[model samples]
Target chain A: MADYYFKTRDLKVGYHGRALLENIRIDLEKGEILTLVGPNGAGKSTILKSITRQLEILGGRVAVGGKKLTELTYQELSRKMAVVLTDRVRPELMTGHDIVAAGRYPYTGRLGILSREDERKVEEAMELVNAGGLGKCLFTSLSDGQKQRLLLARAICQEPEILVLDEPTSFLDIRYKLELLDILRRMAKRQGITVVMSLHEIDLAGKISDKVLPVKAGCIYDYGTPEEILREDFIRELYGMDRGSFDPVFGSIELPRPGGEPETMVISACGRGIPVYRRLQKEGTPFIAGILYENDIDYQLARHLASRVIREKPFQEISVKVYEEAREAAFSCKKVYYTEIPWGTANARLRKLLEEVKGEAGIECTGLQEQLC
Target chain B: MTEYSFHYENVRRRGRYAFVFTVMILALLLMAVININTGPVKISLKEIAGILFAGQTDGTEYDIIWQIRMPRILMAAILGGALSLSGFLLQVFFHNPIAGPFILGISSGAKMVVALTMIFSLGSVGSMSSLAMIGAAFAGSLLSVGFVLLVSRRLHNMSALLVAGIMISYICSAVTEFVITFAEDSDIVNLHGWSQGSFSGMSFGNVRVCGVIIALAFLAAFLMSKPIGAYQLGEAYARSMGVNIRVFRVVLILLSSIFSACVTAFAGPISFVGIAVPQIVRLTLHTSRPLIVIPASFLGGAVFCMLSDLIARMAFAPLELSISTVTSVLGAPVVIWMLVHHCINS
Candidate 1:
C-alpha cells in the first residue's frame, strides 16, 4: 500500500471533450502542505478540481485515502476532504456566520439543518482561519483580506481531513498573502490534514509548502520538498518571468539569485521598447511591448526584438478597439521614451495619445531634436 | 490569527443576528393583522367588534364583508408571501436578485397551460380548476427550471444566467400569444381575466389549493437554509465545501417553479410581488441571509399584497380593478424607493 494519503496515477483530465491536463503523477500524505505553482491557465486549477471531484477525470483516476475519487459522493468526500476555490462573491446581505454555517452541508441531515455539533464545527473553522472578528460583519463589508479569511473559515468548518485551495492569495497584498500562507501551513501541521493549494507566488510557496508541485507544459513537472525544486530556472519557465539566471547556491533545488529591490524599469518603442529591452538585457528589467507600423523604423526594430506587441498601423486613424489596445500598451510601461528621431510632428491625435498617458507611464519624450524629414 | 479563534467569532455573530430576525418576524405578524383589518368600509372599533363577536349581520353588508372581501384579502396575503418567498429562493439559486419566478417563464408557462384547459378541457366547471392546475404545474415547472438549470451549467455568471432566463420567458410569451386566439369567445373572457391576474375570483376552495402550496413551498425553502446560505459565497466555494451544487440548484429552482405555477394557476401572474418584494425586504432588514430574508419576505409580501389589494378594490370604487395593475402601480415606486434609499444609505 502507498504511504501517501492521496495519489494520482498518470492523471489526464478533460471536459466537454477537451483535454485540460495530461499524464500527471503525484502523491501526498497527511500533515503535508503541498503547493502547486504555475501561471494562470496552466491546468493547476483543473488538477485541483479533478481531485476534489468538482470536475470529472477524463482518463486518470484520483484516489483519496486509498479509494477511487469516482466512488465517493459529495457527502462521502466531505468526510475526508474539503476544498476552497478562488472565485468569491461577497453577497451584500450575509454576515460571516451565515457563510460559515454553509460549510456544514455535508454533515447536516437531508434537510441540511444545523445541529449543535455542526455549529461547533463552524465556530472551530472560523477560529482556525482567524476570521472570528468578521463573523458579524456583512460579507460585502469585509476587506479583501478579511473576506479571504472568511472563505477559509467556511472551508475549515467542513472539517475534512484534506483541504484544497485554488489561488488562495491571488489578489491579496503582500502582508496578507504571507499571513494567509502562514495560516494554511499551521493548519496542516496542527491538525495533520493534507493541504494542497495553487500559488502564483513561488517565493511564498517555497517557504511554506512541505512539498512543491510545479505544474508546467500540460503536466505536473515535479513534486517534492521546496528545497528540492524552487530553482531559478524552474520559476522562470513556470511563469515565463525572467529577471535572474539560475545560480546554484545552497543545494540542488536552491537558487539564491540575489534580490535588492525591483530595478527601475524603462521601455523603448519604435523598436523604442526594443533597444531598451536589449540594453537592459544584462540587468533584469521587466518590459513588454510590440509591433508598430513598418513605416516606423524604430517600431520595426522593436517588432524584430520585442517579446510580443499589440502591433498595428502606426499613424492610421484609430478605431475604438485599436485605440483601447494602444492605450493599454502605452500604460503598461513604467516610463516610456519615444527615442527615435524625436519627430515632434506626429499626428495631432497621436500626440494627444502620448500626452493622455504621459502621466500614467511617466513618459519622457527624448530625441525630439532629431529631424523629422 | 489562528483558525480556531476566527470561527468562534463568526458563530457568535450569527447568533446575535438570528435573535434580531426573530423579533422582526413578530413585528411583521403584527403589521399583517393591522393591514388585514383596515379597509374602505371604515367600520369603527365598536362596529367591527360587533360584526365579529356579536353576530349582528345584515344580508348585504354581511355578504360584502364575509363572502366577498375576506377571501380576497387572505388570498392577497397568502399569495404575496408565497410569490415573494419563491422569488427570494430563485434569486439565490441563480445568484441573481432579478431572477424572479415570472422572469424565468414559470408563471407564464403555467398560464399557457391553464389557458389551454380553460379553452378546451374535456369536462366543465367542477373539473376545470384542478385540471388546469395540474397542466399549469407540469408545463410551468418542467420548462422554466429545467432551462434555467441547463443554461446555468453552461454559463458561470449569475447575470449571464439571468439573461438566459429572461430570454426564455420572452419565447414562452410568444408561444402563449399564439395559443390565445384559438380559444372560444367565452373561454377568451376567462383566459383574459386569468392572465391579468386577480384574487377577486378566489373563494374558500381556491384558497385551499393555493394556501397548501404556499405552506409546503415555504417549508421546502426553510429546509434549504444551509444550501441557500452556501450560494452567498459562490458556486465554486460551495462545491469545495462538499455541496452537491447541481442537486441544490435543481431543487431550489423546482420549488420556486412550483410556487410560481401555483400563483399563476389560481391568481394569474400578479406582477411585481415576486420581484420587488424580496428586494424591499433585503433593504429593510439589511441582511441577505436566506434564513432571515426568506421568512421575512413571506410576511412582508403578505402585508404589502394585502394592503395593495385593498387599494385595488376600493381606490376606483364600483369598477373592480385588476390586482396586477395595482401591484405594478404599487411595485414601481417601491423599487425606486429602494434604489434611492440604498444610494443614500451607502
Candidate 2:
C-alpha cells in the first residue's frame, strides 16, 4: 500500500498564460470523502482539476500512490485515479452503455475495442450506479440526474483507486442528491477508494463526509470531522450567514436570509422547536415558555433544561406563582412572543401582559387570532 | 470460420446490425461510379466501367476514360472522404459542433510549405508537384500541432484549447500571405489557383499517392472511433474512462492533418468541405455517434466533392472554375440555410 496515498503541495493552476488559482494544498487518506465547500468563484473546481491532472499545475506538485503525477505515464495515472466533472462535452448519440464502456479504455486495446471482459466491467459499473436500465437510453435524452450517474458509472468502469468528483450532486434533485452521495460513501468504504468531491449541500456534507475542507478566500480550513466542521460559527464565517440555523428535526442548515434580523424574543414550539432553541442556546439569547400541563413537552422541556417557563392550567389566569416565574426571566427582556395560541376571555390576564408588552416595548401581540388565548 | 462469421456481423454491442456500415460502403461504391463517369471528355458510364474492369483501352477510349478522367475522379473521392472524416474526428475531439480540421491551421501549415517550395522553385523538375505538397503540408501541419500541444501542456480548460487553435490559425494565415506577396507572378497564379482548389490537373501518379495516404489515415481514424466518442463528452470524462488524452490528442492531430494535408496537396485547399460535410451528416443522422458519423461523413464527402466537381465543370463549360470557389459558393449558402433551418426548427 502507498503510505502517502494522495496529496497536493502548494499547487497552482493556470490557463491562457495566466493563473486561475494559486497556492493550493490538499491531502486525502483511504476511507475518507474530503468535500471542498466554498462560494462560487472560490476555485473549488480548480483545485479538483489540478489534483486530477485535468489541468496543469504551474508552481507545485501532485503525487498519487507515491509517484509524482507528471512522472507517471497516462496509463499509470489512469489506473490510479478517476474523475467526474460537473460539465463536459458528450457525443450527441452515445448511449449510457457506450458512455460507461469508455471507462474501460485504459485497460483495453489501442483501438478501444472492448473485449468481453471489458464489457463485463462496463456492466458491473452500470450496475454499481444502478444505471443498467438506462444503458440503451440516448445520451442527449438523459435527465441531468441520470447523466450525472452515467458519468459516475463511466468513472467506476475505469476501476481507479482514487475517485474525484467535481460537484457530483449539482444536477441532482434533493432525493437523488442523497442517493448519489450514498453511492460515493459505499464506494469509499467497500472499495477502499479515496473519494474527493466539492459539494453545495452543507447539511448533506456534514452528514456523510469523513473529512471536510472549508475553502474560503483561497485558504483551506480543514475540519477533521463533521461535528467540528458543521459548526454554526464556521458556516457563518464562510457564507456570512450569522443567523443560519442547523435544524435538529429536519437535519437541515437554513442559510441566513439576506437581511433577516434575529428575533428579539424566541417563542417555543414543541417538537420542531429544538433547532430554534439550539440557535438561541449558541448565541446565549434568553427565552421564556409556558402553558404547562403536568408533563408537557415544552413547559417541562423548559423547566428542567435551561431557560424560564410559566406552569399553569390552560384556561387559568396568569396565577401569582407562574406570573412571578415568567416575570423573573422577562425582567431583563422587554417583549414576549405568544405564538399560535387560541384567544378567549379565559386568558384575560395573559392578554394584559401581552398588551403591556405592546405598550412598553411596541412588540406585536400574537396568538390573538385563535379562540382560547 | 469463427472470425469470419463474427466479422460478417455488425460487431457493435447492443446497436443496430452491421448493415449501417455495409450500406455506407455500398453508397461509396455508387458515388465512385458517378465520379468516374462524368468529366471533360464524354465517356459512357458502361464503357468507363468496362475499360476499368477489362484492363484494355484503345487510344481514344484510353485517353478519355483510362488516362484523363480516372485520376481526377479518384482524387475527388479520396480527398473528399479523407477531409470529411478528418472534420468528423475534430468536431468530436473538441466537443465543438463547428470545429474542423482546418480550424487548427493544418491547411495553413501545409500551405506555408507549399509556398516555400513554390517561391524558391526548389526540388527536382519531374517531382515538384508531389514534393512541394508533401513538404509544405507536413511542415505546416506539424508546426500547428506543436503549438496546440504546448498550450495543452499548461491549460486544462477546453475553451482555452479552442482559443489556442484559433490563434495559431491566424499566425499561419499571416505568414502564408507574406510569402505569397513576395513571390513571382507565375508562381502567384499557380499558388492562387491551387489555394482556390481543384482536381482537374491530377495525374494518375498523384491520385495513387493520395489514395494510399488517405487509406492509411482513414484506417487510423476507424480504430479511434470509440475513444473519440468518449472525448465528445469532454477530455476529463474521456480520461477518466482510461483515455490518455495527451496521446489521443497527438494521434488525433496527426490523423486530421494527414487527411486535410492530402486534400490540400492534391486538390488544393478546399476549405469548407472539411467543416461542412460532418455537420450535414450529423443533422442527417440526427446523432453524432462517431461509429456512424465517421463513415457517413466519409461517404457523404465523396459524393459531395464529386457532385461539386461536376457542377463546377458543367456550370461554365470550356471555362474551368476553381473547385474551392464552387464548394464555397454552394457550401456557404447551404450552411446558412441549415443554420436558419436549425434555428427555426429547434
Counting clashing residue pairs in each candidate, in order, gives 24, 13
DockQ, prediction 1: 0.28
Residues B1-346 of candidate 1 have per-residue lDDT tens digits of: 4434435554664575576567656755565445446555555556655666799787555665667666777787888888888788877876666667776766766776666655566433235765357556557657777877788888887567767767877777776677677656666666677788887767877787778767887888887876777666777767665678889877887787777777777778877788798997787667776766788888888877776776776688766588888988888677567557656645
lDDT for each candidate structure: 0.70, 0.70
Writing each residue's lDDT as its tens digit, candidate 1 over A62-158 gives 8888888888877688778877786657576677777777777778786566788887887777776767667766777878778777778777888
Steric clash count of candidate 1: 24
Q: Report the Cα lDDT for candidate 2.
A: 0.70
> What are the per-residue Cα lDDT tens digits for candidate 2 across B84-109?
88777666655555556566666766
- Identify the runs in model 2 with alpha carbons over 4 angstroms from their true place: A1-29, A57-70, A127-133, A218-223, A246-251, A255-269, A272-325, A328-373, B1-20, B39-50, B101-109, B123-129, B140-193, B285-287, B337-346
After aligning candidate 1 to the native by TM-score, how far in Å is the CA of B23 from where it should be?
A: 8.0
Per-residue lDDT over A20-109 for candidate 2, one digit per residue giving the tens place of the 0 to 100 score: 666666677776788887778777887788787777777788888788989987668888888888875445666677777778878877
